[model samples]
Target: MTGRDHDHVTRVMRTVSCDASAARSRLAASWQRSFAHHRLDPAAAPPQDRDTTRLAEQEEMLGRLLHVASPRLDELFSTIGQSGHGVFMTDARGLILRARQRAADEADFIRSGLVAGGDWSEEAQGTNGIGTCLAEKRPLIIHRDQHYLARNIAMSCIDAPVFDHEGTLIAALDVSSPRAESDGFNQLIGAMVSGIASKIEIDLFRDIHSDRQIVLVGDDRAGTALLAVDRDGLVVGATRSARIGCGLARQGALRPVPLRDVLGETSEGLSGAEKAALTRALARANGNVSAAARALGIGRATLYRRMKRLGISGAD
Candidate 1:
């Protein structure tokens, strides 16, 4: 190893073996855990790939997620896989269920233990990209020698967590390569993975709430967030971005809020946005005509007239 690389790993091992509360970042904490809690050998070889004799078994295991995310997976790979890097999708437990690499780098990727069915969870692989990202519940790029194992120093990886229909984290998407340019991995790859993860979440949210009144919140020219409303116009569920867009609490999903309580403006229930906004506003104000009207910035008379036309009931 080069002098700098050796020194870097040595420093990490020392921190990992001691108290690391001063480490504010997740990556630093992970590095500490790799050697301290896990007692993993920092000089160990990279994770080993398992035989794919039962490849169908793994595919069946990830059937629901694969079904929901397959199209976008192809699109994601088509967009990003053609480059020197590769993409891997893993189940919640970090078993690699799918991998896509360009023709030029497939051999190297397979040799690096990125084949389907390989386990990359923290419990198994220490502080590499997929394992650490899954453990920390965040997106990250583990570049070059940042990997805990000496053998993994040649590679860099970016990973993003993917949530299931119930909003449970169920998978991760990893993009990486030994051949990747450091600047590009830092500048663009993380965002690309995050956007793909968000799209999967949006699709999953819609699929789960197909019968409900689902609306995407945000500016039209910009992107949107996914929100699910009930018959009474209560916001029942939202994607992470949607929650942020509507100013909902970050810790737990926000409590059931009326649509109008959150949206700032309203139209006369003619357009989709207007209707969704009015419905939520009326629900939030608890059917009090004047109150709901005032919240919506419309006159009580106008609210009453619109309610009748729109067939909204229980307005006092």
Candidate 2:
């Protein structure tokens, strides 16, 4: 299979789970009661707007998603197999489309009713990273004690919104973890969640974008990119810096460019060698930083520092 094919296959393999039925049932029940059960301090909150009002009545949205979801709800199920992480997806309406956690860590989150079908707006769930990010359409990493609610203070969640072909928000992907783990781990997992959202966006646009040219804009400093690709990586959507690094264009939209070509040459701005070393170490360690550091003959703290310096993140 091709690389893109490989990527999808690997994702499917990594995300398959056996307990999806139980998880779905739990999520549905949670969605039914999230609003009624939640008690927010009105004096400490901000004013609500039109979108917030619409999100308040999400029972129908939840029912639609649960009804249409069948056999294999790939998007919904992906969150469950996140390797000890917690994830939930919400639509533009802020209704929970799905919620899941690694089987090993589901109990604590389940107890808090942070499951599927729940409303997760700042107004409903307080100042949670997921709720706030969705409300504001920004990326966030809310650590322990950062959450507005006392019960949520011990939890950490990193969330990003997913947009469809028209840039309409289709869902929000979030990874929730306990605060005791390294902050680095949370960042990494958040990045992974963003990657998944990006893929979903691509999928949404794949049909209409096949003929349109794309320009790829890479932010070397952030280790991220604004990719505009056709069937193949045709660098059609790119920032000036990305075009300069990849030798594309400066003015109008350019032709399609392959990812291989665009990523073939590492610009002087990016420390490619160091990034490769870090990725290799992490792979060898099976995503365990402490083990990877030992294998690489470095201290765990040193490895974390280097990863942060390199902008490398974990799965959370």
Predicted model with the maximum TM-score:
1
TM-score of 2: 0.46
List clashing residue pairs in candidate 1: 259-280, 260-280, 260-281
Residue 262: error of model 2 in Å? 21
Tens digits of per-residue lDDT, candidate 2, 1-316, equal 4454445334323222233532564322222233234444322333222344444455354444333332223553474355555667677645565666666777876655556645567657666767777666767777765455445556777888765544455567777766366777777767776766665555444433566554444545543334566533345565433545666664355666555567775443447656767787788678999888888899989889889998998532
Count of clashes in candidate 1: 3
TM-score each candidate. Answer: 0.73, 0.46
RMSD list, candidates in order: 7.9, 22.5
True-structure RMSD for candidate 2: 22.5
- What are the lDDT scores of the predictions, listed in order? 0.76, 0.57
* TM-score between candidate 1 and the true structure: 0.73
lDDT of 1 by residue, 209-288 (tens): 88888887887332437778887777888776666677776435558887776786554454665556677787888878
Angstrom error of the Cα, residue 56, model 2: value is 15
